[model samples]
Target chain A: MKDTALLSAPLQVQDLTVSYGGDPVLTGADLTVPEGEMTAIIGPNGAGKSTLLKSALGLVKPLSGTITAWDQPLAAQRDRIAYVPQRASVDWDFPTTVLEVALMGLYRQLGLLRRTRPHHRDKALACLDRVGMSDLADRQIGQLSGGQQQRVFLARALAQEAELYLLDEPFAGVDAATEAAIITVLHGLRDAGKTVLCVHHDLSTVPRYFDHVCLLNRHTVAQGPTATTFTDANLMRTYDGRLPTAA
Target chain B: MSEFIALSLPPMLIGTLAAMACALPGNFLLLRRQSLIGDAISHTVLPGIVVAFLLTGSLAALPMMLGAAAAALLAVVLIELIRRFGRVEPGAAMGVVFTTMFAAGVLLLEQTDTASVHLDVEHALYGNLESLIWLDGFVPGALTDPQALATLPPELTRMALTLAVIALALWIFWRPLALATFDNGFAQSLGLPVTTLSLGLVVCAAMAAVAAFDAVGSIIVIAMFICPPASARLMTNDLKHQIAWSLAFAALSATLGYVLAGYGPLWLGAEASVSAAGMIATVSGLILGGTALAGPHRKA
Candidate 1:
């Protein structure tokens, strides 16, 4: 199964286990994210949905498991992966402009001490434009609304120009227009053959937004194309009766 | 001319250079919310200086700086250990480590007879800038004399070199430093060696403190480390602009405070000037307080 996953998927996690302090948050979880598809990982709160993504990104250590991205270790392929943490994780009042935050995505390429070249600035502006944040490029991050903040984060990720994107709760607390803008950008990434993994909470937009679904509750309950895996039974297992209505 | 230069100019130049050096890295420390580390390192270095003097039996510059740097690094390491093993907040860990180290330093000082040596505990805590005079005896026409320039105290030269090095380090590592300070996780994901970058910053802060502490005392060094950068932060949202503003504020406070210390006492009919280091710290605090109240970017 491991060999088959390596051949078919861009990302594969096998028998992954993780814990915080003493209790395990994830146990023997197996997942494979298909290439060039927008995959949504849906689960109840405290079900380790974000942990799964963090483990894959090497931000969190797993107790016992293997995660392979692009047929290699995550560390070796770090440049190809872009992560957008939950907006609430950052201090919005920090003294930085939107352009400066977006420019951070190019630090890897720019290296140490070197100024951001003209073309890099152009690329950053283009990314901001892609996310519809061009006009607010000079605004302080704290001054932006929740939706605008989310868009700026998307713009920063776009500046990375990575092959795979991992976004933690991108739509949480965002307005409708920002949600639509994010969805458009996700679709654009998918259409361009880039992969995206989002930790999504709202059950109503699962089918409309995602091409693949990974229903998780400390372990993988179901994983496959959205049509077959996003069943009411799998969601019940993932959400553990907290899911209000049957789909 | 010689009298003015000998009496007032050296301390002003020394204060400005020392404050600039401390404020440069203080900007990043403030951004990272580790401003107390400056205070911690400054206090802990006292023990290192005492131990180095005991070991070397001399008041040489290099030995004292090395001792101070070692002590600062040790303080950081201890703080980390306590925070990790003792599971306390970083501020509390720093408070415990620095206060203990400072007490040890004071105890060591009490055990030694330092009257014969130039090392005075009171002078160390509150610098004696008024005593830093040219060794050439301030003859007439001494301002243009090469021999007089050579006789200038080494403290001024040391501070000048420190300022140059601090500026160079900030310029050379601006990108990685900014990225790591702003977002450590993202910087690490980009394979930027965030841990090493953070350690380098702490080491730089330690070195700056060592270079300035002898002439300005830990009080002024601590104030400069937090005040100028923090005031600059309240005035600008851009990092580059913030650095520039911080340097400006540091220079302003040093010059203005020196003037106030020297002349303000005379205006009030006092016979002599007060402590230059203390006055500089007081002025920096006033500037910060004023900026916090009236700066354009003051938080609502």
Candidate 2:
């Protein structure tokens, strides 16, 4: 039974419900993300898309839910998980350099007296290189363009060296070139047997970018291989009987 | 020379140490957009101290600190509860909590027959800085003399130790603190104890405020906590450089403000020296104003 739990999925959520003083943002949201695949969670505006991800990361308190990664609580396996929050979630003008943001990914390794040794710096630099942000390592994060800023965050996540990566809107407001760069990196992560889940929009790019889709509004509308489940019917069902004009 | 060592040096040292202690945590607070927390914590200290004095019937430091820490913790918890349950914004929640506590303190002072003791609102606002005189400083070669060092004002030793403790805390928790302050969700995802770390930061700020409350007074600690770090934010894009700039700015403000308050009136042909704590806060404000005008990152 334990072996089945471990081998079945990288992430699973059951009976997840969330609300904030008003109405339910998400209700009975169940999801299962397969291991070593890139999955996109698509939904329309105010659809609890971000809430689902937040709940899974334990960033938000769900009304009724259970979440597990590798058959264990997320808290138990947090060291193997990396999360990239939305770009709009933080102040870009904060006093920090690109290299410093990348090094933040490695903070879990350092104990109380957080002294970044040479190897840590080397690791951070290498992660920046992975995201093609090595040249801008010394620059402040506020100085970067929107796309460059996203890349820097991606670099920070790469520094974590985790078994699973969860990104919220990795392609939002990014230039085409940066979008390409990000997808390539996501693909690399998948090829390396790392589970990748992204809260995504842009239905036009859904089938192109992701191998699987979890169509959601307040609850899971559809889930499976993109070719089979990411159909016009599922998109309409998830988006409330009306397909959004290509955004 | 002897006169300088006996009267001026101790107050100046106390002021500098106090300023440094507050300014260290001020950097993170300013960056986190929670600068008014310093104001809130310092204001709440009055009620805490008053309660402590009422309980112990004494002016000992430990009881005062314990009471202040407890009050600060309560204030923070209250602010959070109001923010979360009451749906009030964080700033508004803080404003309500701290001001109410401070008013309660004033009422307590009025209600109690504490005039016999040296506890007064005036003393809490503008601490008696000139009284931190070091009799040991009058000894020749006092810098090297162990006996003279032992005779230094307790306020000076305590302020210096406060500064050291705050600096060490900043250094040790540098990573988690920066991570949590910058992006709370990301830090939590990385398994950082975000709640504990933030509470620890507030504890550090409150500790500095309580310690400096005696020497620099309860009010001016806000300026030291704000102005230096705000100016440093304007000056630098790197947290490390910003911290260095704030420490330098803090020391400079303390020294320059002390000298100006002590001698500027004399140079302008006045009789009495003005308030050193007031002058220090004013100097820091002037520095902040200057940086805001011409700082490289001012636009940001």
Candidate 3:
């Protein structure tokens, strides 16, 4: 049973040690994401939540670690995964439209030479519609509000059609409506048998938004289903007894 | 007509072609906020030319261009090394490497006996655009004669070929280029070679700068690489329109600037013409300023 569980896991990171500028950000961290579930990695301000997420996607270099996705190395599983980095990672003033940003999701499939056609446009449009952003398809990315920009990013990731979704704080700095819509889409993805892992803030929403939780403070404090693992004890341990919450 | 073809046609066409070539990759470079890389590459090409002149003991085109290309690549490598190992920011590293290389080139120029050649700091800064005359173009209907074309300045042919290659590369890698420029981290996650693409962009810029350095000066190379694309960036919110606008602005700057430099003084009763390269750079900056004033998407 244990072997079957390991084989079926969507993402597994063992002994990840990452440092930035000679300062260790993550030290001996391990994570195993449950397949087809919404898993949240929550921790305090300096807990390396973002680092762990980026290291999994090969965006951050790991000092000593092995990252596997669906029982294979992360490199081999790149096409099978979609990553939604923080919205602040890109320059909002870049000259691209919403539809164009969404079409970015099809680049790996289009390879280097294949042109985008009508079907690809329709697919990207459908993703925008799923996020209630189909009307803003022609608008420049810089014109969108914070919540709208967050939705546009989610729409792009949805257009990827991947088996695993890794997001970095997708709900941060968004309106309540956008948050609800995003969570609904994420839950739908989980129900459709796609693995969803995200670096989440707002301890108040952990039990409500995520089905599984990994309480992390540099290292994995506890990880399991929300019912058994997201207790007050784990919350205090993750936040260092701060009892902080986000609206 | 013959005078126009022999004297005016070559430089004007060469200036236009060179402008368009640099502006093409300049679109992507501007978007990536690495516009100064063009400045650095153009400056570094100077030392390369001096070195090539030193080694070849002649003003041959091919060897000088090869040397320029090598130096441009070396400048890029040095900047990366400093940024990586020296733990310095990219801007500071670029400033250090390009300036040092350029200063060395100037020193090398002063040290070498180049009295016989048209090589000097002034010539490199303001090119011999007035001297790129095509005497073969003086023959009647020489425009249609293959023999006449054979005697044409090689800089014109080299610039045309360089422009074609840069255009083809941009066309082929449009999507990936846009993705990499917009968000490199996302591109990496998709298994795209973002690093290779970034390096390829620098290589393309270096190629344009080297080719253009022969006819136009470093001033126009750096100016064309930044000004046209930057002006176009304010004109449109779509990448396609941005590229198209940049090319149009580049052509406009080259033609108008070259024409004004060549004849505006003649019309004003002056005996000598001004530097066409400097005029082109001025015109490009003027266009950028115009766009900033009234372009539709000029706001941040």
Candidate 4:
């Protein structure tokens, strides 16, 4: 039993039900994300894609569910998880620099009142370099372009040094170069044997970007390898819209 | 020269310290976009002060401060309750809670024989800085003498100690406070005690409000809690620079306001100066307005 549990998927959610103001957003949602793969959670608007990710991260409490990472409770494995929230969730005009936002990822390790040491700064800079944001480290975050801001958030998540990365709409509103840069980083993370789950919107690039796909609409429609599970039927079922002729 | 020093120095020092105390926490409050909480706390603390006086029959600082802190916390709790259970907007909840509390305080004051207590509604709303006199004659050598410390008015000592405590708290909790204010969701996910830290900040703000209540009045405390920090926020995009600028702006407003209140009347041919607390608030507002106008980072 222990061996099988250890070999189970890196993330598992069973019978998850979540609601806001008594309105059910997701019901009976079950998902399993394998390790060492880039998994994209694809769904239509108001389809509970963000809600699923938030509930899995424990940002939003589910009405009923069991979510485990590596068969352990989220509380026990919190440090091993890194989350990048959507851009709209933050106050862009806040008084902080790109470097400062990236450094916030270290706050969990450094704890309260402790200054960031030299090693932490080196690590943060390296993370910035990873996302091509090293040149603009000292610039104020509010002054950055949308893509640059997204890259900064990626840098901050990189600074977390976690084994699992959860991102929400990382490609939304980003330019082509930023999207490619982010995909390269995701591939690097995947090759490193880390799990990456993203709430992605662009359907045309889903197959090229992700190896695993979870199609959802209020609940899981299908979840498996991208080639096997990302079908037109599943897409139509998830989106409730007519399937496109191409791709 | 001696008489002028005796008359002006104590109030100026008091104003500066009070402004500093209020501004320190004001920075965090402004960043959190909860600046109105300061206004709510200042107004709600009035009933606490009145009830403390009625209970103790003496205008002691410590008990009154404790009462005011409790009342401020109660106001926050009430606002939350209204926001949650009543399903009211946060701003509306704050307005409902603070106005009701302030009215209750006024009713309490009218019902009690507070004349013997040396506290009244007017003094609670707008403090009497003119009466804060250093009765003990100043000795030039008293600056360094330990005995001379005892000669200072209790209000000045209280303000000084409050300023020191506020500064120390900011220095010690700077990281957690900043993280929590900047991104509360991230802070919570990191296992930081975000709620406790927020409560601690609110309590500190309440303490500063209570400490300054006797010298600067609730109105000036409210002004100090919003204006200087807001001006500082407009001037900088770095937290450390913002804090330093906030302190500088606060001190400048206090000193400039005192001088303008005391000396500006002479230029207008009036023999006496107006209220120092009112002037301090005015100067702080002017600074905020000016920074909003000229600040490079001011939003379009």
Best by DockQ: 3
In candidate 3, which residue ranges exceed 4 Å CA deviation? A1-4, B58-62, B73-90
User: What DockQ would you assign to candidate 2?
Assistant: 0.80
- Candidate 4, B55: how far from true, in Å? 1.1
Top candidate (TM-score): 3
Please list the Cα RMSD from the true structure of every candidate, rounded to 1 decimal place.
2.4, 2.4, 2.1, 2.4
lDDT score of residue B34 within candidate 2: 80
Candidate ranking under lDDT, highest first, comes to 3, 2, 4, 1
lDDT of each residue in A72-121, candidate 2, tens digit only: 89999888999999998999999889999998888778756757899999
Note the B-chain TM-score for every model.
Answer: 0.93, 0.93, 0.92, 0.93
DockQ of 4: 0.66
Alpha-carbon TM-score of each model against the true structure: 0.93, 0.94, 0.95, 0.94
Stretches > 4 Å off in candidate 4: A1-7, A241-247, B73-88
Question: Per-residue alpha-carbon lDDT of model 4 for B1-300, expressed as tens digits?
Answer: 555556777878888989999999999999888888789888999999998888888767788987897787788899999999999898899899999999999888888898864578887877867677664435665555677657777889889998899889888888888888988777766767778999889888988898888788888999999999999989998889988999999999989998898888998999998888888899999999999999877876
User: Candidate 1 vs candidate 2: which has greater DockQ?
Assistant: 2
Candidate 3: give the clashing pairs. none
Q: How would you class the docking of model 1?
A: medium
lDDT by residue (B1-300, candidate 3, tens digit) is 999999999988899999999999999999999998899888898889999989998777678878888888798799999999999988899899999998888788888888787677776787777788999999999999999999988888899999999999988988888999998989999988889999899989988988888688889999999999999999999899999999999999999999989888999999888899999999999999999999888885
| Per-residue accuracy of model 3 over A65-147 as CA lDDT, tens digit each | 88999888889888889999899999999999999999998887788889789999999999999999999999999999999
TM-score of chain A of 4: 0.95
